[model samples]
Target: MFSIFKTFFWLGWISFGGPAAHIGYFRHTFVDKLGWLDDQEYAQLVALSQFLPGPGSSQVGFAIGYQRQGLLGAILAFIGFTLPSVLIMLCLALLSHKFNQSPLFEGVVHGLKLLAVVVVADATWGMYKSFCKQKLTSGLCLLTAAALLLIPSISTQIILLLFAALIGCKYLASNQSNTHQRFTPSIWPLITFGLLIFALPLMTSGLPLIKLFSDFFQAGSLVFGGGHVVLPLLQNIVGEQISQDAFLTGYAAAQAVPGPMFTFATYIGYQLIPQAPIAGALVATLGVFLPGFLLLLGVLKHWQHLAHVPKVSGALNGVNAAVVGLLLSALYQPVFTSAVLNPSDLVFVLVGFYLLKQLQLPIISIVISFILLGVASNWIV
Candidate 1:
C-alpha cells in the first residue's frame, strides 16, 4: 500500500501534459519498467477509463492500483497521484492576487507541451496498432478519428462508441463462448453513486459547500472526452458564483500543472470557501473524483472475465478501436496543435520521439531534455 502511494505520488509530481500523455507515462512505467501489467491489461484499463467519466487518466491510475492491491491501494493511488496538482492549484488560488506567469516559466510550459505531443503521439500510434488490426476494427479506428476531427463534442464521442459497439456485435463478435472466471460484481457502488447524484442537488440549498460539491460532481459525471472537455461545463456551473477572471486563472493553472487537470476543482473549492478553504478544496476534489471511482468499483471486480464473454469481447473490441481513435483525435487537436506552433517546435517533438522510441530512454530523461530546450530557447531569444 505504501509503495503504491509512493510510486503514484512520484508520478503525480512529474506527469505533465494531460490525460493522454499521462497514459503514455503510465504505460512506460507500469507496463514496461515494473512489469506490473502487460500491454493488454493496460489497454483494458485504458478502455475502461474511456467508458467511465471523471478524470480519465486518474481513474486509470486508480484502477491500476486496485488491480495491484485492492480498494485501499486505489484510494492511496488517487490521493498520491492527485496531491501534487491539488497543492499547486490550492497555492494558485491563494496567490491569485498576483497570478501573472513569468516569461521563463511560460517557456518551460511551452517545452512541456511539446513533450506532451511526443508522448501522446506515441501512445496513440501504439494503441492504434494494437487495437485496430482487423479490417472492420481498422476502419472503425480511422472513421472514428475522422468523425471526431469533424465533430468534436462529448455527444459525438459517446455516439461513436455506441456505434462501434453495435458494429462489433454484428460483425466482430466470435462464435465460441468462454468464461475465464466467474466473479460477481458488487452492486452497492452503483447504488451509492445513484443515490448521491440524486441527493446532492437537494442538499445544496442548505450549505454552500454542498452546492460547490454538487456542481463539481455534476461536471465530473457528465464529462465524456476526458479532462479538457470538463472546462466548459465547470464554467457554466460556477460562472455565476465566481468571477470569470478567477475561473480563467484556475483554468490556466490546471493547464500549467502536472498530473490531473481535474484538480481545477481544488482551486475552485478553495475559492468558494473563505472561512474553511482547505476543507472546501478537499470536499470539491472528492466530489469531482467520487463518481468515476464508484462506477469503476462497480465494474472492475468482474471486468477481466466480463471481457472474456463472447458478446462482451466483441463489444470490447469495438470499444477498444474507438478508444484508439478518440486518443488519436486528442493527440492531434489539443496535444499537437496546442504544442507544435512552428518548425522548431516540430523538431523538438521529433527528437523527443526518437529518444523515447528507438533509444528506449528513461521518460525522466525526456522530461529534463524538453525542459532544458524550453529554458535554452528563452535565453537564446
Candidate 2:
C-alpha cells in the first residue's frame, strides 16, 4: 500500500499535459522501469479506459493499482495520484489573482506542454510498432488519424473507434483459439454503478452536500474524452450556482496543476462551499472520480478475459490503433500547434525528442531542462 501510494503520489505531482501524456509517463515508469506489465497489457488498459466514460488516465492508474494490489491498492492509487492536483487546483481557486501575471509560471506550463509532445510522440511510435504491426492494422491507424484530423470532435473520435472495431471484428480476427477460462466479475460493482447513476439524480435536490456530490458524479459519469471535455460540462452544470468567473478560474487552475484534470472539481467544490472547504473539496473530488473507479472495477476482470479471445482481441487491436491515432491528433493540434509557435520552440522540441529517444535522458532531467528553456525563451523573445 505504501509503495503504491508513494509511486502514484509522485506521479500525480508531475503528470502534466493531460491524459495522453499521462499514458506515456505511466508506460515509462510502470511498464519500462518497473516491469510490472508489458506493452500489451498496458495497451489493453488504455483502450478500455477510452471506451469507458470517465477520466481515461485516472482509470488507467486505477487499473494499474488494481493489477498490483487489488481494491485497496486501486483506492490508494486514485487518492495518491489525484491528491496533488486536487490541492493545487483548490489553492488556485482561492488565489486566482496571484497566478494571473507570472511569466515564470506560464513558462513552466508551456514547457510541460512541450514535454507532452515528446512523450506522446514516443508513445505513439512504440504503440504503432506493437499494435500496428500488420498491414490492416497500420492502415486503420493511419486512416483513423486522417479521419480525425479532417473532422476533429468527440463524436468523430467515438465513431472512429466504433468503425475501427467493426473492421477489426470482420477482418482482423484469426482462427486461432486457445483454451482460456473466462473470469467472472462481481455483479455488485456494476449494480453499485447503476444505483449511483439512478440514485444520485434523486439526491440532487436535497442538502448542499448531496447536491454537490450529485452534480460532480453526473459530470464524471457523462463526460467523454476527459481533460478539456470536462470544462464545458462543469461550466454548464455549475454555471447557475457559481459565478462564471469562479468556474473559469477553476478550469484554468486545472490546466496548470498536475495529475488528472478532473481535479478541477476540487476547485469548484471549494468555491461552492467555502465554509467547509476541505469537506467540500474531498466530497467533490471523490464524487467526480468514483464512477470511473467503479466502472474500471466492473469491467477490468472481464475485459482481461475477453482480450485474449481471437475475435474480441481483434476488436481491441483496432481500438488500440485508434487510441494511438487519437494521441497523434492530440499531439499535433493541441500540443504542437498550440505550444510550438516559433522556430525556437520547434528547435527545443526536436532537441528534447532526441534526448528522450536517442540519448534517453531521465524524464525529470528533461522536464527541468524544458522548464529552464521555457523561462529563458520568455526572456529571449
Candidate 2 error regions (>4 Å): 178-180, 204-206
lDDT against true structure, model 1: 0.86
lDDT of all predictions, in order shown? Answer: 0.86, 0.84
In model 2, what is the error at residue 312, expressed in angstroms? 0.5
- The residue ranges of model 1 lying beyond 4 angstroms of the native Cα positions read 97-100, 180-184
lDDT of 1 by residue, 62-158 (tens): 9999999999999999999999999888888888856447777777888888988988888888887788889989999988999999998888888
Where does candidate 1 clash, by residue pair? none
TM-scores for candidates 1 onward, in order? 0.94, 0.95
